[model samples]
Target: MIENVPEKAPEPITGPSVVVLDKQVPTVSDVQQEEARRQTKMDAAVAFAREKSDRVRKLAASQQSPFQGNSTGKVIIPNTKVGQGYDLFAPVDKKKMKVLFDWLKLDPDAFINILRLQYHKNPHHFRSGRIYFLDHVFSRIWRDKYPEFKSSEPDHNGCKKKAPWRGVDDIYAPVNFKNTHWIAIWILIPKKHIVIWDSIAKHISDEELAEVMEPDQWIIPYLLVECAGSGELCVQYTLKPFTYMRVTAGVSQCRAGDCGVFTLMYIECHALGMSFSPAFSSRNVKAIREKMAVDIFQEAPESHDKENNDNDENVTTYEQ
Candidate 1:
């Protein structure tokens, strides 16, 4: 997610005789061109990742076996979408599905870039390693995906010797549930808050949101505690320490299929510190889908990703 980086200052012209020069200025068209280049590069990366994703899908579809969970082990959610919640995801929208699918297809770097783009815009505001990597976040490993070779893990297994959440700032999680719907979770460290946003409100209950996490792992408290070790073992240090919080922003998805888009918009708008309303969530979803279709996909650790996403924007933790 490295876009719009701060450019270096121009060096002074060195000579025996000094020449007075007027202050330089960039034109509006120049600024527009630069922005276009940045966006075009992003869109190109997104498009390329989509192609790779399509190929893998076609190959998988051609074969008899189920998808191998890509490289992140996201294979399938073990029939979470089939039970009573089936009706919630019913009356599916084809266009919305395509948008979600396109988003899932992004390669890891492309995905990270989307997150990086926000950080790049406001570096001073966000902690450097604050994002919490989740299973549903679309990503492709940089070492394999990028040609120049940027390695994320030390050993071949993509495992770092230590965990990356020692002093985290903010967190971003994109989640898929029961293989049906998508949701998002964001921890606002500056505000001392955790926000859970779900597109399908009626389908997901308040009680359900309260427990939307692994049996023994709770990420909200982890951010507050000191992680003793690194990588997968880090969770042992802070396993489900009691936590309590509430949803800062709770709203329903206006349309059936736009839940995913709303989840993403929540992230984008929140990252920008902008207020989001029902109108933003309901309309212009296709635009959001198209943008996501173009950027995707990061790598840190599998444990960091095993966490699920929920709504409420508040943790509302309890002692166990």
Candidate 2:
């Protein structure tokens, strides 16, 4: 109060103040806001990826086969879920069906498994991969008129069918291929004819197909012919000269895995007594997948059938 002091000078600024982060950094609400932002970005990315994937798949499918689309020229995606049906489509189930598709390399046990399932699923169903089993000239005689020739699982394990050729009229053989291929030998019992209907005419030889499916057997004295020191004639078994005709038209599988779809459709058409047409090759693999899933869901036993929904997580891996 007596004397005025010099005004205090302001302290000179140095640098920016350092912020210390403690355990209490970022409050709960702040973290939640950041997470929400991240989730929004993730959702956008997922949508973009899904769109691109769908487009590519569509293009690939289009090139493989022709399919009927909506009026806007959009391929109609079938309704997977019906009253009760469908799980994984065909392409997704490829691994499960790989062995079945590869008739040439399928092991005995694997082949029997399919037969067992087919046997149980629908006894009268005309459609099955088993029909191709008859490609062999000598298959231990599924139901040979004589019990001596009749064959069964080792030690006679499986049940006998009503007839040797139960639930089959055509042999649908889908060949693993560079592009695609399906060949069938239509067995007309009444006509006593075995006609090869290959999309790629003569692409597969009769002997080769027959050899691939024939049951394994030790060389028996009876089968061995005494021909110039001995051997069976004409493919190990004496086959009656059945009329052989090759169907070389309209039936074609143009891409990988197309054999499965085309063959399945062929069987369906044959079951319904429809003439073979170009539509089969045109029914793209995607639709085949959807249709197959639906068929499996509807036809498979309830115990085997998971919920008829498109939950990829619930896919049932077929045992090898």
Candidate 3:
């Protein structure tokens, strides 16, 4: 007699089932992938910004000096190996070059005058800035000799050469005389010096001619005067001429050992006789009056005025 008894219901699982954790847990690959994507975006942005900055810098440089381009054509400075026949040397240092450029920037008129004086003193040695210097000297000489003669020609030879005065007609004519503004002087320096066929009629003062023969204290003194009147003159201890060997050594040797000989290319353009308006003069007068009032109220008025005037002159001269 078997009584039908329901098998006791399987005991309900008491609590949560035991979870088996894998030793090698799944990595957060999706999160990592998202982070990588973000990092890539950041890098791209940085690269784009850098590229934009470079472009802006280049554009600014171009705008500042429009005439500065390789379009004027190329002038090569040939390489001279160690065993070259002549001993090559550099005539100027980097600092000196800066000084020279600075002098050129301020009072270009003074630079022109100095160059003319130098050419008159010594025409044979062939100075570095020969052609341009000659041009300035010729213009001045022509003006002095023929005050009434108003032709487009610039002749220092005193009407000797058959070459008619092709003044404004010449491509390299002075800026203000014509409505033209662009002016450039190109020089081709080969391995050896090129002989200028045109005879430079010797027109120099007795003192200058004597100094040329004797390049000692006398000549240097005259040069110093010219330099002083022009602007602040800074001369480096070392005076090196631009040369091929120097350029080669600069490229090949240790940077410190590299020579600082720059193959110079220069262009100067003037905005057609742009003069300051009377408004500027009024503004200057107002400034002067204000300054005077302040000085008059000072304890040592006379001393203050003197010092202020000196300072003002210095500032004005520098601005010019």
Candidate 4:
């Protein structure tokens, strides 16, 4: 105790010592956190790709025809053989078939003609009545050249073939407006009313109606007078006035440039005597178009007889 030993050197004043290892090892929690972070990144990436794909699809859908690589693109129905005595309506050739392909507006020759043939062939499906089918051009031709053909004699204008509507209950015509819109006109002969199914408008102005509906109102009665030949049919239509009407079935086009398809469908439904249902809309219109094309092809006389040879020049493959 008397010996003054130097105060033991204070222990080295160092902070808590750090351990050194040959290789640092991660804890279980550290591994779990890293895996969760990786999974989050992958999910985010997948979501981003899905959004971009959806955007591209929507844009393509807006610009192109919905029926691009459908079943309709498989093969082309051959042209009717010459001198076959095949009285086919709306025979599909290379040109006419193209209407159903390539985002083109439905041409009158291909679409309405084939439909008329279908109506005639399957009478069971159609309403039992004397329904007269007029081509798409019939109304517009009369509209543009009304008085010019008023006195031209129905025979001269080939009205003889479409004549003798002794007991015609209805007349259906597909009409085009401004060469860009399609609508259906149903002349209810007994009702003396023209019901128009316009996919574009629910109701048009009276003035517009008067102007647009003039051809039908005037020419139909006149044709009746000429073709009916002073019979009861002629007298009835001549005496009474035809009124204009717009269908109130809540049927309107939900997509653009689909007016033609809507017009054709309206005529078909009325022809079948079926009520317009919500099932028919722009949603499944592309599928409808594909079916229509196939139907037209099968209706061709050559379709059943001919073999589809790839080497044959007449047999062209369908192009999108």
Model number with the top TM-score:
4
Candidate closer to the true structure by lDDT (higher is better), 3 or 4: 4
What tens digits encode model 1's per-residue C-alpha lDDT throughout 167-228? 55566666555545667666555454556776676666667655553311233343334344
- Which ranges of candidate 1 are over 4 A from the true structure? 1-112, 121-164, 188-193, 214-252, 294-320
Kindly list the per-residue Cα lDDT of model 2 for residues 163-245, writing each as its tens digit: 22223334433333223344444554334455555544455576765542232112111122211122433233222334556
Using lDDT, give the best candidate's number.
Answer: 4
Candidates in order have lDDT scores of 0.50, 0.42, 0.30, 0.64
CA-only RMSD, every prediction: 33.4, 23.6, 27.4, 18.2
The 10-residue segment with the lowest total lDDT in model 1? 311-320
The C-alpha stretches of model 2 lying farther than 4 A from their native spots are 1-182, 205-239, 301-320
lDDT of 4 by residue, 1-320 (tens): 58777767777857888878654788889899999999999999999997765552222333345566433322232222347586588566866556545332555435555656777778777886478676654465567776554445545433422323346778888887776677788998778789989877743555776778876776566556656665565555563347888775676564767777778788888888887778788898777777766765666533222342311432221110
Q: Which window of ten consecutive residues has the lowest lDDT sum in model 3?
A: 256-265
Q: Write the per-residue lDDT of candidate 3 for residues 184-249, one digit (tens) a residue.
A: 222222221111111111222335423222311122222223333333342311112222111111
Q: Candidates' TM-scores? A: 0.42, 0.35, 0.16, 0.56
Q: Tell me how candidate 1 scores on lDDT.
A: 0.50
- The total of clashing pairs for model 1 equals 32
Clashes of each: 32, 2, 10, 0
